[model samples]
Target chain A: MKRSVLPTIAHRLAILCYIAFALFPLFWLLKVSVTPNDLLYSEGVRLWPSRTTWDHYAFVLQHSAFPTFFKNSVIVAASTAVVVTICASLSGYALSRFSFRAKYLIVALMLLTQMFPLVMLVAPIFKILSPLGLTNSLTGLVIVYTAFNVPFATFLMQSFFDGIPKDLEEAAMIDGATKFIAFRQIILPLTLPGIAATLGFVFTAAWSELLFALMLINGNSAATFPVGLLTFVSKFSVDFGQMMAAGVMALIPAALFFLLIQRYLVQGLTAGAVKG
Target chain B: MRKPWLKRLAHASEPWLYSAPSLILIIAVMLVPLVVGISYAFRDIQLLNPFSGGFIGIEHFRDLAKDAAFYTALKNTLWWTGASVILQFFFGLFLALLLDKPFWGRGLVQALVFLPWAVPSFLAGLNWAWLFNPVIGPIPHWLFALGLMDQPGNILSDPRHAMWGPIVANVWWGIPFFAITLLAALQAIPRDLYEAASIDGANWFQRFRSITLPFLAPTIAITVLLRTVWISNFADLIVVMTGGGPADRTQIVASYIFTQAFKRLDFGYASAIALVLLVLLLVYSMLIILLRQTLLNKD
Candidate 1:
């Protein structure tokens, strides 16, 4: 079969176009963040600015409330990731290993959770949390984020668990090890990629959550990155350089985690889809 | 000593014990709140007024029935969801097909193309809003140069064009999700199938129509349906970019719900509107399921 050069060029061109479209926004973000304030308007629409500076980054870090927001977001997202991963691993293992009667019911409930609008829960959750002193706190955000993330993470972990051979855990159990010990010592180490993928996914999701965070947390002391950035944007609408600098900082952890675990994430999704 | 019945009980309870933490969390944080939220639709629950919590008995729904803004938001939701879903799906499918073929620098290309999904929704919104701004952004200037606009003006403030700003941003952000899933499904198709098709003298379109389409049908159906529902509920871009401004032109039901709750501080009305949106979504989902069932039955 003679391969045509035309199709190959077209394919490469299409991929390049897609890549440009995807990264153009982030590139613009980076460009504007580094652009000096005076040049932001004068050099508008230029691919690169004539002059650039780190002054905006310094201002956001030193003068703004963004550091507190960043710290709070990191705490909430990391805690949610660790907590959701632990719970999902146990539940996902059970689903992969057992054929219990309520299994179908459990699956249905999780699916239901995925389908409905979560915005509906804002008022009720606020009502419930306010009295308990959980509202306006990072602890409340972690708890809420963990619950919101568990179902999807559980399904993800289940698919990963399904890919592994049951015999590894069974053999360990047969050697007088408890099932929990087998899962901890033998199986857990093997599923590190899956665990990493789950952590990354949940962390990104928790980091990005806005509406609930905005609704529940009021003060800047407990505000997550999204709430803080939104407030900053509204308050200082003219400070494009500073806001873009903050936006660039917000993208770092999520992007790093995503680039690391994206391969496993797609693989896990494929496994789940085939089973369904 | 442990008896056989006690051992049997432990065996039966093992999965339950494993699932208990997640189940409890879901019930406490999600399920209980959902029930309370549904209840809120009937009661007058004002955020600031302590004495406002009372059974109003369908009063909010009645007010909602007459509200013109609610109706406009409902219409906007359909337009927003439809445009975003269709554009994302086609672009995503094309990208997936392009990536599926072996090419140089494929890994790097894949990483770069999917980077948009990794950006937080709020930031994506702001980034796009800035892009459309005439002062610091380039999009309006480009539009002016292309003669698509009278002058370099921000579309985010234009009632007629405001919706497109968020829609474009959404399509850019969401394409990667569809591509990733479709790409996974594409890879799962056996390579031999394509080889055999080529041997049969089938052209690319014929092969794609007969082989690729059938192989990807289940995935396409599931992903498209899910994306439609999800996009309809997604208001982050709209909320962040326009704040549903310029006379509520970009306001979808989701953003409307946020406005009512956050700005008006009227929790009951917000819950009422949310309940209606929820019911509409359920109906839509049921219709899709039924349609799928019938298609399956015919086969």
Candidate 2:
């Protein structure tokens, strides 16, 4: 049976609409970031600015506390990503391969942890951190973010580990390698895509997290970019140009981070789309 | 290698070793705090000296029973989750179906559609806030030019429209995940099945209802479940957009918890609220599992 052209046309039209809907806001962000401050309010409804400048970007980078916030955010997010991936990989491999007595209970408990809303635990978390003088510090934020992100990351890594065949590891073990050696030398190398995907996912999540960062850190020096973005909005008026510029600037690291791992990300997305 | 006692010990101990790091981190950071939170919920703990307070049993729970803000937050949270998940899934499924076929620029379109998922949610919320600005935002301006609104700020300021702004933003951000997941599921449907349907003279709608819908149901159910959990926990966007404001009309449970804990420093009361949310989510997940089991049994 031949497919009809009308249905194909309709299908393409629908997709085109979705693409526009999704990308419109991002395009708007890029547009407003370049628009001159004076024209932000004056030119009411223009898609493209009449004139553009890098003034807001320059001012946000040079004059504001954004750079510090960016640096702190990088430290916190990167550390959390590395920490969570390291933890999750070991657990995920165990969950995938082992049949320990408490395996079922452990998986259930991890799922239970994911069920609780983060908001509910905020006070208890703060109380626990404050006594150790961990509150108002990047390390505290990293610890909290890592805890919150690990459960989901573990599940993510577990799925990846499950996808890889057990034959390879069994073969490695038979060749006189210990189980640890089999995992480290044989399985770990094969899981580079999973590691990259997990790292990217966890990094982006911690990078954009605002609640813990806002609650745990109070001062400008330790604030992450999300909290710093709030500084652009005062009680009186919002600095649209500056905020948009900062927003654009904040996209750089995450964008670069993703660009570096796009190969893995693409592979990760498509890896399980079809059966091997 | 064949020593049974040593092998059993190794097998038993290996899991513990493998899972120890995750277990310790979760226990220290997640489970301990959760247990402490439950204890605090029964106490009258202040932020300054959380350990100093004596346990008041269910006093905080009783207080929450009469709290109007708590009820409002709960209601708003339900509204947020229901609206966000339903809209995102449907729109995402629609897009996935549309894009399942071969077409020109399909790869570019898929990339563009998935762009929102790539951008951070905080920035997306910020961008939407600017877009909805009454005087300066192009959206309101466009609405006014089309005679759809009398003024610019009404949408963001009005209680009725406040929640919708964040919902729209969330839906925009979420559609991509559903699209990608559903597209993956759609592609997995064997081409031979579709061809067989076409041979039977089934039209597009008939083919979808007879074959596509049934095959995609499991994936769709899982997607909906995941989306529900995620959207229910979504407070960051609301925090940026309305701060649960315009008279707390948009105060979802997550944002409310943030304010109660951080702003008010009422650790005990906040913990009680958080416990209630945890219970709700558990119940929701259980319900989904039951429904999924029943659906599978029907087949």
Candidate 3:
């Protein structure tokens, strides 16, 4: 049915308000990132900068340790995303398709894993890892992030697997293909959207993870972007321009990653919303 | 018959093989750590000498029972979860309803509203920190200019308002997830039901009450449950904003656990607090599941 004009206008207005509220911080981030350092204090709450400069960006990139942090963040997030997706895909398919004897128990246990606060597990995890010489390293962060992220990602992938018809894989299996072959050849290709979604989800999660990185990595050498941002805050004065610039810069990889995977993200969101 | 029996056996065995890799990984990575965490809760194991502790039994639990910080953290956690989840869900549903109607620019508007979820939580927190800063932050400046606040440092630095500052930031970040999920549910309602209601002379409110609310109940409950769990466990925003200070006023259980473990180096005591947190979450989950089952059975 066609909506009336009045309600349509109201709906548009409401949505516009919501959009403005959501995007205001991001717009502010960009606004402050380019505002000249002198204008930052004196602009007196202006929406747009009177004069714009790339000094903050240049300083963060060339003068600060942000470049190193950005590289480390990319390496850690990409590695964690790749590793978790691989592990979650294998496991998610099993959870979706199988009915083994301990399947219920395993599923319950996995759900249980998600229940406890990550902070609660930090000490024990540190204890476990510190003995293995895993602390204060990028590899440790990746491993920890991968371990923490896998359960949720597996559940995400499992739902996607459930959405796909099993008949396609069964048909492949019936044609004399081994189960792994069917999974690799037929099922995996269909689950690309799910894989992409999982990758994007896990990548951003690891990319922005701060608590573990703060606790586990003590020095500037192995810091992720979040920890690196803290360096902008010294004992006395906070550098607003530099911090905002770094914050804006940090958005780039995540934005690019999402841009690449948005097609799948949209598909994944709408997947089970309605019957075909 | 022999061939068919062999095929049945293979089918039965295949699931085990398929599930083994994940099960093993979960057990090694998650289950073992959990078990170790529980045991460590009963000890006085300091980080400096983790293995040097004897089983102190219920002493840690007893100590926690008397600790004022534990109580404060527990109270703050309840407030954070209750307020954040309820507000996020209400605003999310409101926005979802507004967007449910077809209008120009709906797609672009939806994309913009959902952008917060795309942004990293850390960055979101940092952005809000800047926004709430007393001197340089625009929010206090605007509030002062508008005469809403007598001075600049009222919101961010005050013990009373610091928690709410982070809560607002979190609600900003969380609203999009709820909106998207609830919007999906709203769109899934059969159009024919509304048509039937209108045909029966029901007005918009009546139709929404009779149809939309009931249908959306399950999705709403699940969403709230998920959000409750997530918001309760949320420590990052608080860590970034206040670090559980001016006087440990904003310390939730997660941040409390973090402080105990990392800052104090009292791993055993932290483990105890962690166990308390685990038990609390277990009870909450069980309660939600039971409620869900009851609701489902009624349906």
Candidate 4:
């Protein structure tokens, strides 16, 4: 019996169409970033501009507050990811292994956190932080971000821990290792991929956060990349090329990080979403 | 030999010790402020006004009741959330199915496709905005050349269809989420079921209905719930693309709250609107979960 090859061709064609749609905006961003200012309007709507230069990137680096924003974002997102991961690893382990009295309540609390509009917190957080001088501070952003991300990261990590067999730790306990030691020495090593996935997920989330950063941070000194970019867009609305260059720059670290960890992310989700 | 009381105490607290840090942070940062934020609705707390912190019960809500803008925003949120979620889910499911099938270079294709999810929401918003720009963007020109538009106007500026701009951008960014989760769910389905179905003379649609749909139901339900909540609260794209304008056509409840708080600096009013939204969302989530439970019981 012979099967027609039409289905396979159709599938490939459909996939290619998706790929084109997915990458088109990024392609446009890159294209405009390279196109010099003089030719920006003259060669408007061109897929590939006639002439290109790196001047926008050069100026954004030298003339803008973007580097400060970049540095602040790195600090905020990195710290939040690390802190959340550490907290989540422990809590996730508890959720996976323990049937404590508060387990249901804890799960419910996390679910409640997920349900509410975070915009509610803006006013209160600012009011609470202003007296203590946390508003407009990177430390404040990290604390708030860490809290916001913890619930989700904990859930994701719990799923990972669930995927890990209980027998390995049981074996370690039989060899006279305590729970913490066994967790540290045996199960933790096994969960490196999950940890990496958590870190990457939280990092991307913290990096992309805008409303909180916008509300909390005041000036270039503590402003994250999002705040800086929005300010740039509104203040210098005409400089599309430069703004696109900065935008492209912002895309690089996250795109690279997600690209590197996406495999483990999928693997982690395999143990996560499909299960519970 | 009996263990020491201290050791027993430590053992009893093991899970608590593991969970303490997260619990503490969530309460201090989230729960405490959530209560405080809820109270901010009953009291005035303007940022720029030093004397604005005063008890003003029900006034904001009364204003919100009368505020036509808030009602319009409420309607817009429904449209935005409903359209974006449905479109994203279907597209995501399609992509998941496509990726689930074995093909050459599937890995590269996935990375490229999922790349947008990694892009910061801010940039995703701005990039889409740029795409809709009449000058220096091809979308308008393409639309015009295709005769869909007479003059290639940015639909983001067109009040009647402005919401579609952000909805399209949202769909583009969010499809990967559903795709990823569904793809994971797809992979988890036992392969033998399909094999068995084929042997029993089940066609593609029959196999999918019997095996795939049943397996994917739990995931679909959960993702749809999560995405509905998340997307309803998601104000980034709307804020960036329209800033709640071309006459507040695309202003969602979340964005409206943000505008009230950030732009208007009206903490009391923003919190009031937020409280209403929170209540509404809580109701919606409860309904869905209860529905899921009833369906599961039937199953």
Candidate 5:
């Protein structure tokens, strides 16, 4: 079939427009972060400033508590991702493979978790964690994030597991391997893409979470990126350059992780949405 | 003692063992807190006041009944969720369709367009907030240049238009999600079906209506339903951008709950508000499910 040139051009233009819309804000973010403070107001609407400096980034990294926030966020988000992925993998494997008594109940509970406002749990969780001394701790953030993420990650991993043929594991089991061994040695190798996707998803989620972090963590010592940045914003509202620099730094890890796993995420989402 | 009963029991319990850790976490962190949170709604549980953890009955709810701020927030939640979801869905659907047809550099374009989703919600809020800031951001200047306003000013500070700031940010961040999902569903539609439709003299819109719509109906329904519920509960943008400010114009139930708990340290009142939001969401979900059921039954 011969495609019309006009339609093709129009389609390309539309895609370009969408791409620009998506990237413009991020571009502006980068733009303002590097612009010299003296020129910020004068060249407010310029697509690109004639001259730019990295002083803002330097100041944020050197003079601010952002490094601590960055490290804390890495610890919390990485720990939560690892823990959530482990729990999700096991539970997801069961849901994909087994016909158990509590299967429906488990599904129902997970769905219920998704349905309600997570904000509802804030007060109770704080109250519960305070006595245990988990508040203001990275471990507490990890635990809460792990639980909040597991349900969706389980669903995601389940869909990926479903994509793999059951015959592969069945064959392993027939060779005198326990079901667990078969799953470990045979199935897991096949689901590496899924695992990567889940890790990325949960990592991004834990990284970006704002309210709970704001509520639980108190001082700059324990504050995650969101909390620290927000505090910085409120305190130094006029330091747009430094704030944008911090924001740009925060975007790096999540964006890199996302670009890596987005393919599998879309694939898994399709499998779950289409087949289920 | 290699007993058959023991083996049978282990076989039956295998899945449970595998699921136990996650189950324990969920019960401990989410389920227990949920129950305790519900209990909190019926009691007085201020964080600062040592004498405030008493049973308060429905007094909080009675106060909620007359709270003008609560009503504004409730109304804003509907508007925020509705506008954000609809805008995201349509723009997302358009982008998905555009990407569905293979093009030069499609992979690169897809990644570029979906990059916004990777941004932390807080960062997205702050980024948009910066854009709307008149001093450093360009949006206000653009709006002014277009004669939409008399001078460059922060939209985030304008009570009448404050909600749109977050809504716009949300749409930008959320569009990629719908696009990715819808694009997947679009690709799943059989190519031959489109060929046959075209051969039968059906035009693009007809093909879309008859073929694409049906293929995408289930996904559309599910995503829309889920997004509506999720977006209503999403308050990070509002909190970060406006803090529900300009006299609480952009406050939603979720942000209102946060305000009560975090700022006021009124855990009980926050829980009370959260409980009401939860109930309203449950009703909304039930209605959607019932509507889906009746539609299925009709067919």
Candidate 6:
């Protein structure tokens, strides 16, 4: 029952290779962003530059619309995540603890929302929102993103809720607390990890949403990071260094949230997989 | 005795009360727009033209049926979706299996490998686009060094191979999704079965072939189905990278619909194209479900 030395070496090496492949592009992105303008074309494609500077980062941070874009993206993504999690927690709670006639229909409807090309909704959504003064507003983006994320977050939260024993809530119910109070007091506290995971997931999802932002919002004032970066890219097609610097900045929050919550994500996912 | 009927009504209404807020939002945002979007497929609904909301039946469909770009896009959609899903799934499965084994620094490695999934799709596209560029990027030079191309050139602008650029970006960005899910499924697998199999002298490959694959099958099925639908409808990468350019070679149905709506400002035509794509996807999903049903029945 002894494992071979060569096989273990191979396994370790393979994992390292996968990690390298996953990280190399991002590495190159960071690499190019710091290389000076002079060395950029001359020492082009070098793994590392002989000389590096923070000029691009400085310019992006100090003299660009990136701060505004960052603000807008934060507003849109955070608001969407918060709103979606609230709705999903309620819906997920309902699905987990209740017996209702429309349960199957509700599930099916949520699934149906997942299926269609959201691009189809573009025109109609724009049409519907234009009159309400919602178009070109962050609120509109939040509303659209909340609806899109609620279904998946509900499913995710439902799995986490399912993992908690029913007796935890039932016991609370029998102790004379209302179901709402029991859920708020007993259940929500236990699902903090799941809630964190959902918030992180929805934040990243909403952060990366580009098409709707592009379709619905316009002008520089309200542009999210994606739209802002896109416009920045097209506007300064020659300035690769600055653009990559901005890209690096955009990666910060989502990556931090992801690194923190990924363990919980896998945990929640395993719970769901077990149920399946 | 208490009124049991009133209590029963309260019990029945409670869950709905909990669920009502989400249901209301979905109906307003998703459901209503969906119906309006479907109706837009038949009616003229130009964004610019205030006079364009007239009902025109099947005209957009008829135009779409005849358009040659739509046909090319259909073909590209198949190739794009098929290659992306297949590559993402296999690599994801391999990575999941690799990580499932105990190793030192596994926690760090797991975080590193999954980092790409956190990168915004637009940034992923832009990052790869820069990578494929001849100036200030390493990928083309690497390809040149390997003699894969005559010169360090941008494949993103090459009509023959532009599709691969975005496909590669997509595969990289999407791999962790499958990996994370598959790894969860792998972990969900009870370890005792493997221990029992090994006690009977089964090798690793045999144990995996018989036990791991079967355990992973259901998760694999559902994840793959969901991913296929999701990726087929995903247009961000293509839209950002190629803009569905190099003469529409990379234009999938989703991006094509986006272009029709966003650029042309033709909501009616875009909705029509979206409707057709929706119908096709529904049929594909039904077929998969039925196929699984038959396979299950046979089992």
- Give all candidates' CA lDDT scores: 0.86, 0.81, 0.79, 0.87, 0.86, 0.87
Name the runs in model 4 displaced over 4 angstroms.
A1-4, A130-133, A162-196, A263-276, B1-12, B190-203, B295-299
Question: Model 3 - which docking category?
Answer: acceptable
For each prediction in turn, the share of the native Cα contacts (below 8 Å between chains A and B) that it retains comes to 0.65, 0.66, 0.53, 0.78, 0.76, 0.72
**Colliding pairs, model 5:** none
Deviation from native of the Cα of residue A258 in model 3, angstroms: 2.7
Report the error of model 4 at residue B7, Å: 7.7
- Give RMSD to native, each candidate: 4.0, 3.8, 3.8, 3.2, 3.8, 3.4
Residue by residue across B207-282, what tens digits does model 1's lDDT show? Answer: 9998998777766776777678888888889988998888989999999988888888998889899889888987
Between candidates 4 and 5, name the one with more favorable DockQ: 4
In the predicted model 6, the residue pairs found to clash are none
Tens-place lDDT per residue, model 5, B56-162, is: 89999999999999999999999999999999999999999998886666767877898898789988988998889897788998999999988998998988898
Residues B1-299, candidate 3: write the lDDT tens digits.
79999999988877667656666666766777788888888887786874657889988889999999999999999988888888898899998888777555555566667677767787788788878876456788788889978877637578887788889999898897788667656765777888888989999899989899987887677567667877888888887778888788889998898788777888788888888887888898789878977987997
DockQ of structure 6:
0.56
Q: What is the TM-score of chain B alone in each candidate?
A: 0.92, 0.89, 0.90, 0.94, 0.91, 0.93
Docking class of 4: medium
Interface RMSD of each: 3.2, 2.8, 2.9, 2.6, 3.0, 2.8
Q: Order the candidates by TM-score, highest first — what do you get?
A: 4, 6, 5, 1, 2, 3
TM-score of each: 0.87, 0.86, 0.86, 0.91, 0.88, 0.90
Model 4 residue A81 distance off true place after TM-score fit, in angstroms: 2.0
Going through the candidates in order, state the TM-score of chain A alone for each one. Answer: 0.87, 0.88, 0.89, 0.89, 0.88, 0.88
**DockQ for each numbered candidate:** 0.51, 0.52, 0.46, 0.60, 0.56, 0.56
* lDDT assessment of candidate 3: 0.79
Error of 6 at B258 (Å): 1.4
